[model samples]
Target: MSRDGSPPAATQGPASTGFIPGNKIFNRRDFVRERFGAAAWDAVLALLSQEDQAQVASVDPGAWYDVHLVERLISAACQQLKLDDGLLMEMGRFDADRELSTVYRWFLRLIRPSFAIRHMNLYWRRSHDTGTWRSWQNGPEVSAELRDWAVSNRAMCITLLGYLGRTLELFGGKLASLEHTECRSEGHATCIFRTHLELPADEPRPGRRPTRADISSLARELAHSPNREALVEALVTLLRFQFGCSWVEVWVTGQEDRMQLMGVSGERGPGDQRRFVLEVAGRAVGRLELELPRGPGQRGVDEVLAELMPWVSIALETARVDRSEPHHVEESELARRLRRAREIGQLTPRQLEVLELVARGKTNKEIAAVLGRSEGTVEVHVTNLLRKYGASNRAGLVAMFWGEL
Candidate 1:
């Protein structure tokens, strides 16, 4: 009986057959023929002993044959061609691509990774019934153990690795990894596979910290940015330097998902469900989205972001010239604002820090508490910003900081 409950197809190898499915043999034939050329495939066979050659040449893909034939044939090919067991891995990969029926292959491609991997046993039994397949799947991770199954060849494990790895790829995994943790030939009771898909985060991790060096560099680089595009590029480069590999972007804050700044150091997949709030003055003014590479995040990003955010705020403020901006500020608007504000006197970083608190509706006392300043000093900053923008009060001062002036 097979997974579908009917008797096994005549070509399907059953547990009693002591042989892999005959179609797998056909796949090997095709693999050798396609990869090595027709003549080279013959050369491979010629390396085998005469009796083994005769048996292999006369092999019927629909009939059961000795499993040891694989061991002998693979060994001969490797020894004569100065090759390695990577041939078997390639052969297994070829089988995965060529063996599945066209309709079934497409069906598998259209489904989710979790669903397909969870029901992997059913797919396994279709090819070999000799072993018990124990599988567990969690979101993007899957583990499968093969107990009491020996193909009489240790090199075959490499083939299985390639086979299952390609299987994950076929089902829409981009940066998936497959590893064999335990091997029966190595005296382990079962052959275990640990598979993981490096899926992007579904949402932001609040307070995710970047290092202090990253923070300092971000501010320094941004301070030198000459244009809006350059500012975004600087941020992208900073992330790549921090992560070693990353696809990072600064997306616009409004309802529109229109993107502003993006940098890709490595390849990216289609879906990226993660985004951290890019903030200024304690508001999510934008998003820091990523098409993360194939590894865990490095440690301590949030502390850096906290120090880095105000600088990013100033840079992005200069870049708010896009048509998407509801304010419809002109391309040279920030330059105009900077020039006009300077006529009232160039403001210091401490003055900008105070303005940030004012924009958040903080009173002088509240702003003092937040910035570790006296209320009197906070009141002077508010008074100076107001005088600089010719504003009547706090409300107009905040509006000028937001580029309304």
Candidate 2:
């Protein structure tokens, strides 16, 4: 059965009866049709039986095309255009991998919902060493139509090989070889492909130790971040540049056993890829993940994370505190105390006016109307007052002013 609980289409016969519509196939068909023109598309269809041609003609953008239909169409298009299979395979690899990297971070999520987390974890644990990565997918389990194609037109497996190769290459490894180790058509339980990556040359590599200046500059940039989101984003960006990883992501635990993606740098990968815990006072706050190429240059990743954790902890704590309620006190008492503090000298003319309205218990909107200014302007003044007074909220600002009075 497919993900939507639809029965798998049979593999051995005409695809007209078994094909299902999918976004991937729909988009591919439209692109091919537009690129090759109606005459070419009709010619490809004419290569099939009259019934199959009618089915192709009837396919709508939203409707599902049989897997067989889709595959045959691709083969027909390539043949008609006199495109080399190897060239087409490489094109498929490049286009599919590019799309998967950029716009389809959750590509596996859509296809393997049940094993998504497990698959991700597996990808992360697997070493990206040259000649290290290998994986297999049971063709029969994917779709009966795929199994049928495997049994009959085995040459079409080049498309699958290209796709798998590109997927591995996305992990910052080069494909050295990909061989079909097992095939359902050959009486194996599942189709299996073993992959090998070209190993990096063994050589003495120079260590990229972070200089004192680099650390100081990074610290300064992070410290100047105005909010937690900005701080996390800056950290992710800095890590990506420092380590030269393909991607980085920050995931924090959320309510109800969920994980929230706080920030990401670069194209998101399928799995955790590489993960380190972010702890504050020995309590886990979040995780930092990355996908890096095989090389000697990434040896400093752990040291960089160690240096980063303290800053990240501080930022997370500050954000949490900022969201919580400020210490409560009577409003009149606070206002009275502010009057006595006589700290009005700290405020500019406009800020003083804004502060007075705030002390008078006016909302930002009300203050804006009374001052004949924008609500945004009033908000800025209020924020400035809180910052200048070292206050957490409007109430705290009032308390700081009145306490001094």
Candidate 3:
């Protein structure tokens, strides 16, 4: 100020203007966005790894199985990738096997991230050099360890594929596909899976993270569901669509800790049963349970369930209120007397109009204007209608209307 002008008139230095050293401003939003993006990427990787491990664990290499576990895993994964509304539809084991091969092939072509895939090639060397399917001897090079690892790896691959497929499928509409190819060589079994990865030009990209408003809207919708049955139905619908569960049920607790069946959805397997307890506001309200597939998880479904828990608790509280006993009512003698008077007197239309207007706290002049009649006419109508209504005055008429309606 001293250097540039006559007076230092309301001047801001470099620090106040945010141009000085150590004057940096941090934005919490931008920081959170960066962190969330990183976390999502990490989660995707972890899920892929976990699914692979699950598939591998389900295999027995020594057994003469017609269908490979890896193939099934891939199929389940691909179906999951393509599913709509985060639902896991029921598919047989055989179908899952077919799907794995399909997803593996598709992923190679479309979403070909730099990942290695090992396909198992098995063969039997006959004790005699006879080229037949039967009477095969163990080859010198193939050890038990190798065989076990192959089966395990295949299973792991399938599991990984199932989860991956499901995750992608939830997003909808051809973001990926699966293809499979197997080759038979001289004396060994070999399956070469060429997963085709296709990243189409018009393929949809990842969407923006849900805002607080979006979460709030979903919560409100969940809360506003009409009744307990409707709320339980919503929960069942969520499990079916999201987790691909076989069955779901909800229970509400009443006095003396007795449980009531609130709602049930889907059918369970033979002799299968499960249960969960629901608690809200430091009190046990109800429970939810479901029968799930003994396979890789559908995380999208789990995520949604976790998000809905608070809303679910809120719904239970609402149900508790509805379950309470209703208010008591007994008609007083004065109420009875009014009804008798109204029946005895046949009040005119004008009188009825004036009576209602007076009960609503309008003056005679106001009632006359509303009815398009003279104030005197309105007064007379009031007198007659009051008699017809069997009320002593405006107060009695209001009470009578409240009781009858």
Candidate closer to the true structure by TM-score (higher is better), 1 or 2: 1
Write candidate 2's Cα lDDT for 1-405 as tens digits: 111322222222543434434543544455456666767666766666666567666766555556666556555655565445464465456445544633233222122221321133233222111112233334212211123322223333444556666764543346666665555544655555555654221111122334433554445444544445545645654555445555766665445424556654354434336777766678665677777655665556556656766666665555444545232211234333433333544555467657766875778987776555899998998998888777899998776665555
Positional deviation of 371 in candidate 3, in angstroms?
A: 62
- For model 1, residues 326-403, the per-residue Cα lDDT tens digits are 432222343344434544557664665566457656678766765557999888888988887789988777677666
Ranking by lDDT: 1, 2, 3
lDDT (Cα, 0-100) at 227 in candidate 3: 52
| C-alpha lDDT score of every prediction, in listed order | 0.58, 0.51, 0.40
CA shift of 139, model 3, Å: 71
Could you tell me the lDDT of residue 29 within candidate 2?
52
Candidate 2 ranges with C-alpha deviation above 4 Å: 1-23, 26-40, 54-63, 74-88, 94-101, 105-152, 185-189, 198-405
Model 1 per-residue lDDT at 391: 91
TM-score of 1: 0.43
Could you say which candidate leads in TM-score? 1
Count of backbone clashes, every candidate in sequence? 7, 10, 51
Best by lDDT: 1
What RMSD does each model have against the real structure? Answer: 20.6, 23.3, 30.6
